[model samples]
Target chain A: MNISHAAKASGLPVKTVRYYADIGLVAPAGRTEAGYRSYDAASVRRLAFIRRAREFGFSIEESRELIGLYQNDARSSADVKKLAAKRLEQIEQKQRELQVLHDELKHLVRACRGDNRPDCPIIDYLG
Target chain B: MNISHAAKASGLPVKTVRYYADIGLVAPAGRTEAGYRSYDAASVRRLAFIRRAREFGFSIEESRELIGLYQNDARSSADVKKLAAKRLEQIEQKQRELQVLHDELKHLVRACRGDNRPDCPIIDYLG
Candidate 1:
């Protein structure tokens, strides 16, 4: 299949599929006679796997590790679990950071008079 | 002062200051005879405010709006409070999304056997 077809099959954007091909994460299985990129069934399958991993919030580098484990017949399940745990921790860190921002902004929002007056606690704090 | 000095005073990276200047969000106060960017004290203050807003999770476009209100002496406090409320909502939405991802990944991690074996429920689910 062409990049667009592969992207459709994988439920990924065409640009993302092209980026994967360019980055060598999922190179086209072959080139057509006219030099068009073409992917085999296995390449399409790999793209689908990468799509699922990304939807699970894996970064490209982490997805590469998962892809390695996926392809390695003797790979340890422990490695996969570790990777997933790391992603969970990263999500937790982001949530904590966002929570802090949420609370801080909420406080500023509350403190503001929010009327026709030029004076604003939110602007005062930002300044 | 030159862009670097302005950036230092504003606690923003030199590149970021340059970007703001280029985008016309915070244009340089003037240019030196040597054609280097120069910023006045008032411009520096605006840059500092923008930096603080960004740290508070405001996007560049949102920062521009805040800066506009800051420069407008007749600006209503209600506008500033509305912006802050919007930022708070954005942060909350991100927290919810991250929490969902965290829970899903945690579930997958728990289900995995995580042993020397090649079998992985995570991989199976992805597949």
Candidate 2:
């Protein structure tokens, strides 16, 4: 299939499919004589796997590693578990940081009068 | 003051200060005799304000709007409140999305055995 068909089947955007190919994350099977990118069923499968990995918040490089492991029959589950653990740690840290930011912003918003007057504590807080 | 001094005073990185100046988000006071970017106290204050606004999760364009409102004495507090409310809404949306992602990833991680064996549910799930 062509890029559009591959993208549709993989549930990825056209630009993203192109980007993955450009970055060598997931290349098409081959190119047509007219120089358009060509994808086979296997490529579409890999693309869908990458899309799922990305939706799980794995980085591009991590997705590449997961793809490698997914293809290599000898690869161990421990490596995949380690990467998922690392991602879990990152997510937890981000959640904590976001909670702090959310609380501070909430406090500032609560203080602001939001009236027609020019006086705003939210502005003052930022300033 | 030079860019370094401005960055230190505003608690922003040197690259960020230059980027803000280049994008006209926050311009310097003037060019020195050697054509270096010179920042006055007022510019430093504005840079700090922008830094705080960004920490509160405002985009560059939104930060520009907040800066404009901060500078304009005739501006109403209601407009600033509106911007902050929009940001709060965005943060809430992101929080919900992250929660969903976190939960799904946690489930996948939990199902994985993390052992030496090649059989892994995480890989199977992605596949």
Candidate 3:
């Protein structure tokens, strides 16, 4: 299939597909005589894997690491576990930070009268 | 105070302070005759605010917007509320995605029997 087809099948935008290719995230299976990228079923699977990993909030670097592990036949489960553990810790940290912000914002929103008056705790906090 | 002092006071690295200035996130208060960037208390406050906003997971662009709100005395509380709401939504979405990934990883790890044997469900999942 063409890049567009692969993109559609993978649920990623054509531009994103091109970008992944440009960033060496996903390489085309082959190129047509006209120099357009071509993707086979395996390429589509790889694109899907990349897309799913991205949706899971893996950074490009993390995705690259995961992909490397995916390709290595002799890869140790321990290594994969370590990477997953690190990613989980990072995610938990982000969640904690977001929870704090969310709590603060909720408090501010609640404190604000949200009326026609200019007085607002939200503005005060921001300022 | 010099940029180094401001950096120390703000709990940011000198390189980060310079990067923030370079990216127009923070501006120096004044310039010395010797071409050194100088900061007063106001600059320090601004840097602190920027760092705090970053800790709250606001992007550089979002920080810029919030800074504008901070400076605009006549700004509507509604505008700030909207931005905060948007940020909250984004954070929630990320949290959800991360939660899903965390669950999947936990499942994979649990399925993997960590033993001396080479067989592993984690590697199977990755591959």
Candidate 4:
């Protein structure tokens, strides 16, 4: 199928399809004689898989690694598990950092008087 | 002071100081006759405030709004509270979303056997 058809079937935008191709993330299976990008069913599946990985918050480089693992027939499950573990660890760290920010902001918000006065702890904290 | 001096005093990068000036987020006090960007102490303070705001995960636009409020002496604390509350709500929503992703990924990781076999539940899920 054409790039448009592949994008539609994969539930991704046409621009994203082109970008994946440009970045060598997911190349089309073939190209038409007229020089337009053409994709096979397998290509579309890869595209969909990448989309799912991104939805799971994998960075583009991580998605590329995942794709590599997906394509390697000799790949061990341990490698995949390791990658997922690293991503999970990063997410947990991020959650902790965000929790700190949330607590700090919450405290400042509670201290501020939401009235006609110009005195605001939030502003003072940022300032 | 020069742009470099302002950036050094504010603990921000020189590139970031130039970018803030270009975006009108923080303008220099004046320009030297030689066309160099000149900044005052107040500008350095504002730059520091903006840097702190960004460190709090506020978007550039949000930082701009906060700076505006900071500059306005007659501004009511209610407006600052509203903005901070909105940011807090967004952070909570992001936390929830990240939690969901973390849980889902964790479940998939647990189901996978980290062995030499190519059979991976993580790959199967993405595929």
Candidate 5:
């Protein structure tokens, strides 16, 4: 199939398909004589796997590693678990940081007068 | 002061100071006789403000609005409150989205066997 057909089959945008090709993440199985991208069934499966990993909030690099493990029949499940654990740790760290920002911002918003006058604690605190 | 001095005083890297200048978020006060970037105390203050806003997870655009509000003494406190409320809403939305991803990924991780064997449910599900 063509790049468009591959993208459609994989439920990804054409632009994303091109980007994945450009990034060498999930390039087409072959190129046509006319220099157009070609996708075999296996390539489309890889694309779908990438799409699923991305939907689960995996970064490109993480998706690449996961795809690597998927492609290798001899790959251990431990490696995949390690990557997932690392991703979870990162998400947890961000959650903690965002929670701090949310709490502080909520406090400042509560203290602000939010009136027509220029006396706002929010601005003052930020300033 | 030179850009380096201003950056040091503001606790920002010189490259970041140059980036701020390039993006016009916090340009230097003037250019020296040799066309070198020069920063006054006031410009340093704005850079500091931008740095702080970035630390709090504000986008460069949001920091620009905040800096504008900070510079305008006649700005109504209500306007500041509005911006803060908008930011709070965005942060809340992200937190919820991250929470969903976290929960789903955690569930998958828990279901994975993560052993030396190649029979991994995570890869099976993702695939």
Candidate 6:
């Protein structure tokens, strides 16, 4: 299939697919006589894997590491487990930060009377 | 006070303070004869405000808009309210995305045996 077909199958934009190729994330299986990229089922699977990894919020570098491990038959499951644990820790920290912001914003919003007068606790807190 | 003093007071790095100034997020109150930036209490407050807004996940442009609303006496509290509501919505969306990723990662980790054998469910899922 062509790049567009690969993109559609992988649920990534054609631009992103090209960028992935540029960054060595997914190299096309071959090229057509017209210099366009060609892909097979294996290439499509690789693209899908990359897309799934990205959706899970893995950084490009982390995705690369995962892909490398995926390709390496000698790779240990412990290594992947370690990476997933680290990602979970990062996500938990972000969740805590977001919860704090959510609580603070909810309080500010609740305190705001939303009256016609200019006196606003939201502005007061922000200012 | 000097930029370093302002950074120390505002809990921001000197490089970040300079970046904020370059992006028009905060302008120095004045400059000394030696070409060093000078600040007053007001500038420090502005930096603090910017830092706090950033901590709340507001983009630089959103922070600028908040600062603009803050500076404009004629600005209605409704305008600020709207901006805050939008930010809350954005944060909520991010929280949802992170939650999904977290759940998926948790499931994958739980399924992994982490054995010495090369046959791994984690690799199976990734591959």
**Which digits, one per residue and each the tens of the lDDT, describe model 1 over residues A1-127?**
7878988988889999889988989888999999988988899999999999998889899999999999999999999899988888888888888888888888888888899999998899888
Cα RMSDs of all predictions?
A: 2.2, 1.5, 3.5, 1.6, 1.5, 1.9
Tens digits of lDDT, candidate 3, A1-127: 9999999998899998889899998899989999999999887877877777776667888888877877776777677677667777887887787688778877776776665445567656644
Q: In candidate 3, residue A95 scores what lDDT?
A: 72
Q: Tell me the lDDT of candidate 1.
A: 0.90
> What is the DockQ of the complex in model 3?
0.35
Q: Specify the poorest-scoring 10-residue window by lDDT in model 5 chain A.
A: A118-127
The DockQ-based order of candidates, best leading, equals 4, 2, 5, 1, 6, 3
Task: TM-score for candidate 4, please give it.
Answer: 0.94
Tens digit of per-residue lDDT, candidate 1, span B6-77: 999999999999999889999998998999999999999999999999999899999999999998999999
Report model 4's chain A TM-score: 0.96
Model 5 regions lying over 4 Å from their true place:
none
Indicate the docking level reached by candidate 5. Answer: medium
- TM-scores of chain A across the candidates, in order, are 0.92, 0.92, 0.91, 0.96, 0.94, 0.96
User: TM-score of predicted model 5?
Assistant: 0.94
- The TM-score of chain B in candidate 3 is 0.92
Which candidate comes out best when scored by DockQ?
A: 4
Question: Which docking class does model 1 fall in?
Answer: medium
> Which is better, 2 or 6, measured by DockQ?
2
Q: Is candidate 2 or candidate 3 better by lDDT?
A: 2
DockQ, in order, for the candidates? 0.75, 0.83, 0.35, 0.84, 0.79, 0.60
List, residue by residue over A29-90, the lDDT tens digit for candidate 5: 99989999999999999999999999888899999999999999998888888888888998
Which lDDT value does model 2 have at A94? 83
Task: Report the C-alpha lDDT of model 6 over B69-125, residue by residue, as the tens digit.
Answer: 777778777777778888988888989988988888888888877766556676677
Better of 4 and 6 by lDDT: 4
